[model samples]
Target: MPFKTKILFLCTGNSCRSQMAEGFARALRSGDMEAYSAGVVRHGMNPLAVKAMAEAGVDISGQSSKTVDDLATKEFDWIITLCGHANENCPYFPGKARRIHAGFDDPPALAKAAATEEEALAHYRRVRDEIKAFVQGFDINAAG
Candidate 1:
């Protein structure tokens, strides 16, 4: 049998980017990658993220927002941070878990400049697609 890489996607909050990455990894790389996501601090799930992902045919609505502490016993092969904040303050993990940064824009923060609801959601959609591309092209050997 082939080995599956256990991956953890992290960010400042469990609300958007990291959640989206987790959803995409599960939907696209379930065979090779075991994916989980968490935050340095919990900020609850973002509805806009769910809506954006639903449009992309990936449902992230059922995923919850949580902190790294929630995953105390779980170990990872790769710890990927989706924001500068989480990368700067990432916790120490035991064993051979390698940490990497894959930062993406904060959708809510970007949406602050939007003029309308659709415009705001555009930010979510764009970031969702960007994250999808990143997750889809993730090269395990390169990281390993």
Candidate 2:
């Protein structure tokens, strides 16, 4: 059997966008990839992110909020940053991990300004779908 590509999705907080990307990658590309997510600072998993992912048939409720420090010893094939803060502050990897920056908006921040619960969820859903599309379209084999 071939080895699976190891990927880590990173963001400012391991709460929303990165978590969603990790969930989507795990659900959609489990055959060729192993996905993990972490943040520069842990903000705990977002409930709205869980709901948004569940709406798309992918459950991310079980995933926890983790800081990049928690994954210090692990090696990854790719380190994908899902937010500008994480991209700019990404830690160094000891091995040959390739770093890629694909910034996504902070759903929580966007939703905070929303006047209604539905409006807040709309932001979460949009970012969720966008992250899903990005994860689904990722070429695992090509990363090598």
TM-scores, one per candidate: 0.96, 0.96
lDDT of 2 at 132: 85
With candidate 1 superimposed using the best TM-score fit, by how many Å does residue 45's alpha carbon deviate from the native?
0.5
Query: How many residue pairs clash (N, CA or C atoms closer than 3 angstroms) in each of the candidate models, in the order given?
Result: 0, 0
Per-residue lDDT tens digits of candidate 1, residues 23-49? Answer: 999999999999999999999999989
lDDT of the structure predicted as candidate 2: 0.91
Error of 2 at 61 (Å): 0.9
> What CA RMSD would candidate 1 show?
1.1
Candidate 2 stretches with Cα past 4 Å from truth are: none
**Per-residue lDDT for 1-144 in model 2, tens only?**
779999999999899998999999899989888999999999999998999889999999999999989999999999999988998999998898988898888999999889988899999998888888899888765653
Cα displacement (angstroms), candidate 1, residue 18, comes to 0.3
